[model samples]
Target chain A: MHFHKYEKIWLIFGSGSLIVFLMVLGFAAFWKGTHPQSHIETIDPQNIEAHEAFQAENLGLHEVEDGKYIVNIVASAFNYDLGKDENGDIVKTIRVPKGSSVLFQITTRDVVHGFQVAGTNVNMMVEPGHISRFETVLKNNGEFTIVCNEYCGIGHHLMFGTVEVY
Target chain B: MSTKQLTFSKQESTLYMVFMHVTFVSLLIGGLMGLLQTLVRSGKYTLPFNIDYYTILTVHGVILGLVLTTFFIIGFQFSLLGKTVGISKKQLRAAWLSFWVMLVGTVMAAITILIGEASVLFTFYAPLQAHPAFYFGLAFVIIGSWIAAITNFRQLYVWKKANKGQKSPLLAFMVTINMAMWVIASLGVATAVLIQFIPWSLGYAETINVLLTRTLFWYFGHPLVYFWLLPAYMAWYAIIPKIIGGKLFSDSLARLAFILLLMFSIPVGFHHQLTEPGIDPTWKFIQVVLTFMVIIPSLMTAFSIFATFEITGRRKGYRGVFGWFRKLPWKDVRFLAPFIGMLAFIPGGAGGIINASHQMNSLIHNTIWVTGHFHLTAATTVILTFFGIAYWLIPHLTGRTLTAKLNRLGILQTIIWTVGMTIMSTSMHIQGLLGGPRRSNFSEYAGGEQVATWINYQLAQAIGGSILFIGIILMVYIFIQLAFFAPRGHEEYPIAEEESDALPTPKVLENWYLWVGLTIALILFAYTIPVIDIIKHSPPGSVPFSWPIGRS
Candidate 1:
């Protein structure tokens, strides 16, 4: 019911810090549009192949609009791929033109996975049946490795894909 | 009532001793695994017996995080309840039952991990399922704890009925609330394990809703960290002040923190799932607010503890900007270890706020930064505080006095732990920011040019891990010396005086149902919609078994 003067001061101060923090976070997420895969996109995990964008030709890259590309990927078992990992299943090396607004729309075929572009802001948990889409523009010409940061299975360590921007 | 001594009964002492030994053994194994994990990641060596990185990571998390902390907290609480409430022999039986059940559960889970069937890490999200035995074993561990909670509750109920509205003994009140929070919060994981994983592992369920299961996991996961933390808080509240020759800054404040914990701990778990899909940003933001609310109590702890030190120091004639800190007992490992641990939490707790932020979570989620944040709070704060408690506890339980040499070694060990954690956690944060992911065998990325950039931090982690391993060995040495070789003397329970001006702590602090009801409501409101939505739209789980695990 009662408290120390110092304790009261600190509590108010700490709560202020918390409020300030949540305010900035709120601003970034809402105003600045730096949210996570919050407004999510979904898929039927049992039938990844049947998904429209996941069709063989559409797997690697599809133009959602003029000059904007969506890299549709199925992150599963290990590597981030266009559809699935199997014998001769190539880990997609996405070559994007510099300054392209690339939307990475990815989901897992089997287990929980993470799609993280090394040295970039594109990171989202790739869960089965739940598509995680994040849009970013590759401004510079460079190669960025897309690694699965989540532990899917034993092969999680070997799981990676590439984005070669030119 | 300023008596300097409080004693434990023979049975009470035995319970404490046995559990403390369990803590020691579990710590040794877990600590070794932690070091080796970093080494293997640094590409220096490989695990023997077909063992792999994930297996070691799983064991490292389980033994250290779950087994050691649970065993120690139960033991510590029993000793406290025994001294404070005078547990009947009947009550002691319930306590013993809890201990043995937990031990069996731990063994079962450990065997599963060793045999390579339960390499599912501590989070064990479904579809990447473990053996049925692993799920059952962990269930036992949780049930064992629930049984132990019953004992705590039983003691409190008996005490309260007799005392008739008198404020419960401070330690009992805090421990009871801590246990109550655990019991309430663990329901999420308990449900996931029982209704989902166990059946799935046994082939009863054809598939699981992965999002639904992960939702359930994070629901319990965040609160589980508090379960590790609150005992160390109990220690800080009651014991640390006395060791520093001070009194608790405020008993009511201490009571309020625990009460607030019961209110806010469980409802905010959604913050852990901020990056995962199938959870709405609105719900995530709401939980972020709740997560931030939890920070208030911790800040109270920081303020209360610092106030206690200042008052104590001023009384002893230390003054000026930081002279009071200088006057405090720096050489006393009992105070020193936990003090540094507390300091580490400031940055750790700050990092937690970032992780909870819907926007900022993007920067560090799934990276080793999250791993670093955990080590700072749970690993250092809780683990170091436990080390501090052991300095007195092992000797007290073993009927021996802590010798000067043991204290000296303990001081050295504590310093090593702080330095090692500093190197390890800081490097982990930098590397994670630099895009090094955790929980994988990075050796699989060995010498790839991009991976090559991570090499130095990886080397730092190995160095840090080796230093930490040395600290663990010294801690064991100190424990053995205190428990078996130190000379006999009486040990006193450290109970700091509630600052005398403080009114008797509000009796409402002792009210359990009101807080528990609110907590349940909060959890339901926070989790129900998201969980239902996940299950509604979720794809059926895939069968992961037919696939070879790694390098196939």
Candidate 2:
């Protein structure tokens, strides 16, 4: 029970650990300060106007050949449900055109997020200061869930996006 | 006729032997899988690579990564901490049960993956589903591991109960931290599997949230690496000195590092998801900063352990920063484990610092660079420590002295491990920088000339992997020889000198550092969770459906 006298040893250990912990904390703080802020700034998918207008045309065609269509994809570590039925089931689908290659330039305004076009071989990482490019051939037209493959935060799994191949 | 029953000590030894047997068998299976993958991928043998790649890859990951590591943890826990904590017969039996469940589950999982029924990378990302049995088997294995973690903590708690005010023995404290981390990490995955993935795959839960499962898994997955590394650190802190003719430099530092590991390791799991698009970049950045922050304990450990070596070397009359190196026993497996581990630490730590850097991480995230980085840290450093512990401790536990010649060969095994890891890691980093993707089954040439020369690198990788496998086999042989053929005469074993022995516990065991550590854990955990919660409930922007607020 005489650990009190061992303060010398504990101090050696404690002080050493404290210094290192502080150094690392300093590094993280410095890095965080230098990096740009990464919060969801805008969500175009939720725009009712954009949804209804592009409902027929954008039915899975993420991009057009030489035609500029502005679609904003927000990157989140937590889960976001892109496909859910009216009955609160995951039955909602996306429709994509067949025999077309679409360029899906995804960027994360916030923390790291994964853009995985499920079942058709698409998985890309979106970082704040970076744009992740995924160009894929729409071989088969079916509803695909663009799920996040990376573990963001607690809600990382619910952060899903929808892509329909028509 | 008189019947001679074995003592509980003997029983523990038998239990330890069973785990080692499982380890050697798993290594052989993993090695064979590696060899087969090499042959087929190199086109040296003409066989349909179709299902074989997935099957072999799964087997390789399961055996080497999870199963082997699990066995090592159990064995190390029983051998080192068990004695110190004075684990009870009932709890020891419980530990035995945990081991069996893990072994059985591993077998089931390996068989399922081998048949191409479960091709999901051990990551087991959702939607890209696998056989239900595969998930169940994994669940079983984890449940068993959870049991082991619980038992370890329970033993420590009981020890604390019996010997209140006495500081938990150094080894017990480290193992306790490891066990605590295991419980928290596993809960994340267990929740996903039990509530979401398992039920969804079994047709019980309709429309499972893929995002939730990933969040849960990585929460579990990242700390799981620490679970693997901390025991090796224990061996370094607690055992390395005895082998090298010196006492531990500072037990308090060892304990403090464990506390830091438990505190910082879990919350920083988000860094792994940085490249993914689902999470807020702000939080990802926070996690990255935290990830770098976690390096503090690592640096402290490096300084403390190295300082321990210096103090020990000075005691032995060696002088200088590198001068301490001369006094070290180069050929002793016990000595070589920490030496090689620290040597690999140089690159491994550098890789970690690089990977944790937000901008630099972008360059090599999910590429062969990440693969190379972890190989040096996890495979080379940690596994070498495992070998050293087995070489030094197993004989003592079994009342034996191993053949010094094979122990010398065991040092050679560590050399092979170090060399093979360096070659593979350096080559993989180069390949990743040249834009080679990681976790890919096949590599294709971008043009007629192969844009990144990925094919050559992949070929080189297989060769390096094979060498690593051979080195693993050498380890298996050395351990098996120690267990079965080594002379089990307790009287003949050498006793360490007084000066070389670890200092016994001090008079007053109650220390403020322990409470201070717990306080920090509380603050850090408290600080991070709410930030995560605020982000969770805030409007998810036009992320498809009107985002559910506060669903959980």
Predicted structure with the largest TM-score when compared to the true one:
1
Deviation in angstroms for B67 in model 2? Answer: 1.1
Clashing residue pairs in candidate 1 (N, C-alpha, C atoms within 3 angstroms): none
* lDDT at position B491, candidate 1: 57
> Which tens-of-lDDT digit does each residue in B271-345 have in candidate 2?
665445445555665666566556767766776677667778887788766888777788777778667887887
Best-fitting candidate, scored by DockQ = 1
Best by lDDT: 1
Per-model DockQ: 0.62, 0.09
Model 1 lDDT per residue over B1-552, tens place: 122234677878888788999999998999999999989978887878778788889999999989998999988887777767668778889988999899999999999888778777888865676778898999999999998999988987887788675677788888898898888878888998899888888898887777777777778888889988999999888899899988877778888899888888888887888878778887888888888888888988888788888888998899897788898899988999999889999889888878887767778888899899999999899999999999988887888887788888889999999999999999999988888888878644523566777777888999999999999999988888887888998655677767666667666766677878888888888878877777776665666452323321
Q: How close is candidate 1 to the true structure, as a TM-score?
A: 0.96
Question: How much of the true A–B contact set does each candidate keep?
Answer: 0.67, 0.09
Off by over 4 Å in 2: A1-123, A126-166, B1-8, B38-50, B448-452, B491-552
TM-score of each: 0.96, 0.75
